[model samples]
Target chain A: MSSLAVGCRLRVAVLVLALLGAGAVGGGSTAHAADDGELTLDSIVNNVIVGHAEDGNYLNFDPFATVELPRIMVARTADGALTVDLYGSTKGLLKDGTYGLVPHSEGEGGHEEVITESSALQEAFASKAHLHGDIVRTSGHVVADLSITRHLIFGLLAMGIVLAIFLVLAQRYKRGVGRTEAPHGVLQNMMEVMVVFIRDEVAKPNIQGEKWRTFLPYLLSAFFFILMANILGLVPYAGAATSNIAVTGVLAVMTFVIGLLYGSKDHYKHMFLGPPDAPWPIRVILVPIELIGTVMRHLALAIRLFANMMGGSLIIFSLIGLVFIMNVLFGEAMAFGTSIISIGFTVFILLLKLLVAFIQAYVFTILSALFIGISVEEHEHEEHADDAHAEAPTSQTSGALSDRLDAVDDAVDDVTEPAPA
Target chain B: MTEVIAQSLVQPDVGLIFWKTIAFLIFLFLLYRYGWGPITEAMESREEEIESSIQRAEEALAEAKEIQSENKKARREAEREAQRILREARESAEELREEEMAKTRDRIQQMQEQAQAEIEREKQAALQELRDEVADLAIEAASKVVRDDLDGERQRKLVNDFIDDLPKN
Candidate 1:
């Protein structure tokens, strides 16, 4: 009990420290605010957004104070050989001569202008120097800025956590923890339940046949990864990797690739030629529509996950930003009063976000399964269909076939049955 | 504000994508190999074990039930056989008792007959003895009278005459 109290005290202390640090940054912005006549909404938006990969600034729970991540850039030198530049932080990169921070434009009223842009910055922008948080000289271009950003750090952290959990679970399984006997303890049981759920509920129902085994590993990994990332984001100082479009894009692309690569001939035939029974004119029209629809589905999968995660965080940030906005507009007393209302809404959204996190992960995983299922589905062709119909009566003598037919009949009867008098 | 928000929302950096893809793929591969593969396999095996164990238990229960029924049938048959043996024993015992009673009745009848026969034989013998005595007394009286009247020759002739007259009567 005493240890618990001490832990709570430590958390409170850290929260207080974070708030103080944020307050300093927020107060320091008043100098810029004085020049701009007043603090605009742009600052709040900028604070909420993850600006660029090269930007060392990370959005923390405190809202104002940002954590700087390490900057890494691979630039091509004049000799055409690759050179890697490493800095402890973005500030260190600015101190180095190879790259410079592009100035933010004050009145241009966009993310490009969120930071006051100087003439020198405009010149750099004209010269085609990439101004993504850090300037890369357009003449001697950088191969890739594989810098470790805040999101990347969080992403890796999420991966590390997932790996740690599963690796232990794997070891336990190797030692026959859940194999020969009933699984004991919360962790083992939880892992078993999730694995079973994904296999039985998600993969089996969607991706049917023996093929489910092939995709089960990928599906399980995607589900756990997304779930972990979403939950991590809800923590005080962590970010949701799925909130980034790029991450979701990569995930969606993987699903698309799997579908494209492993799709049955019938799958492609259906998409490209429509149903064989359809008229030629109708088939031609349907083919392009189906093709577009397939692409759109994949795109939607990525966007849906990304938007849901991003939107939840955005709402929470906007709610907290209201308190600061009130402080600027109505003085300290009104701002203090508004903090209660703002915090109330923020907490409410936070709870909703927690639910959304699980739901989005589920939605993403199930949809991927569905898409893969459709691609890999085996269907009896028209000729085979006729043959099956001819053989149906004879096949009915088999007990298994008859039982299956009975089940189907029962399902049909249930659907068609009227209300009892 | 909208432009700033839009830029933030829409911006995608190559570096982040590249890193994310790499990290995610690595995670997927590592977990697929070590984590998910073994875990799923374990769960599948566990399910199969449970199912087989239940089936085995059911089979054992059925066998036990079958054995119990067979035992009951044998016990019933043994009970019936014992009842039949007891009944046959009781019937033989009753027959033996009746035979002993008949033998005792025949022995009593034989003894009574023997006793009656002896009594009759004795009566006949006594009767004969009485008759002989009477005869002897009569003869003696007749001889005394004769001796007083005549001489020895005349007495002999009178006794012979009396024996002859008795023979004729």
Candidate 2:
């Protein structure tokens, strides 16, 4: 078995080297005509990273087969009128010539060359205007390009899958399938385990009290959506939606909104005025710090998830890119030798990325719960303290003063004994 | 190089975020209504069922244990009652045997006393007959002698006196 594995590894190394060799040769020949270097690290990064959407451009898993997604664009005409164009494919838009692909660089000349014909397919692709964020030309002026990018498509796909799975599970539960009987299939059982985990482990402990239930649906959706998006990104040509800062940002914003909306009077007071018992001098120093900390925490939440996911994919791409890099830098034989090491590291990192996918999802969910928990936490101790002070007797009567002292002691005991769990 | 990396890393498209938020909110609402709501309720109901079933089983086990102990107690009581009855029966049988033996002894003593009295009376009668016979004999003898000599009156007197002397002998 060990020998067989070694032989397989040897074969993979050879295959990788051959591919890299071909890429190196092809890239060298094409570099003169094309603005972008083919198969270079930058090209690989651009290909892997989140980019703007191009119409009808499918994710290219292989050179022969692709998964096509719809392109929706908002463009402006020569008269400064807005046009919303929906095309079945980027090829259709290119054929129409109402919109043209802008070049990445205009060379020494200051004029930007826009590709308008199907004959300029190579130049059009080099321009990459098919990507969602890149601006397209309508009568030689740049227009707003709000198209569905690759990551957005994958994000929607992930959401759809999550919805479909849980919807079925929900229907089964409603029909008394899982309710009255033991959960029948793997999908139902797994979904139940996850839901229960989120409820018991994530929501209950963090968001305390009945408020957890109100926030549970949001937490569950976010967790599953992120989890599905992360897993789907591992597929050959799919983009990780969580890897995109915009998606994570939106999630964080939602969490922030929920936190603010549900925040208790005490929560806001603590943020703006420090603790009520603290001296005036200390309050002045602490309030702004506390307020800024709240925003920063949410910001960190977004960036953490985005960075972890993007970092994992980037590492894997870099590892794979190393073979091509070595082929270009060193001789083909050296590149072939390096492929073995490169592929090994790539496989290892891929596994790590899978683990990171689940962890990041869990982290994001729990942190959101924690923030919500802090916001909604009731100030029972403070209320008890206030009640105790209110019942204290006036100092005009000496006997009543002693009784008031005892009352204060009893109140302190009451407050300390039933501290919130 | 760092700028390039940073730009790639932090790029947030406004359009994407807007659509994502809408999609996510719709998903959250739909799932809450149809997916999580029913699922969580079912799980909770199922958990309650399992808990109640366990409690009932425990109660039944406790009841069974109580009955078993009661049966044990009852069986022990019955065994004690049976032993007491057996002991009472043996004691009664012993008392009856003793009473019969005493009755038989008293009857034997009375019969021996009666037999002794009868023997005493028979002996006395025999003696009287013997005495009379002897007296008769003596008279006859006396008459024979007197016929050759004296009178009858003197013979009767002599016989009466002779009977009396013979009793003394």
Best-fitting candidate, scored by lDDT: 2
Q: Worst ten-residue run, lDDT, model 1 chain B? A: B1-10
Residue A177 in candidate 2, Cα distance off native in Å: 3.4
Model 2: residues with Cα > 4 Å off, grouped in runs: A1-58, A76-82, A106-111, A121-133, A139-144, A381-421, B1-6, B118-169
Candidate 1: where is the Cα deviation over 4 Å? A1-40, A48-67, A76-83, A109-134, A381-421, B109-169
lDDT per residue for candidate 1 within B1-169, as digits (tens), equals 2333345454666788888888888998999888887888888898899999999999999999999999999999999999999999999888888888788778788877877777777666665564445444544666566657677666656655765576431
Candidate 1: count the clashes.
5
- Model 2: residue A407 alpha-carbon error in angstroms: 37
Residues A242-330, model 1: lDDT tens digits: 88887888899999999999998877877797755567999999899889978987898888777777767665665676666556645
**Per-prediction TM-score, chain B alone:** 0.66, 0.64
**What TM-score does prediction 2 earn?**
0.77
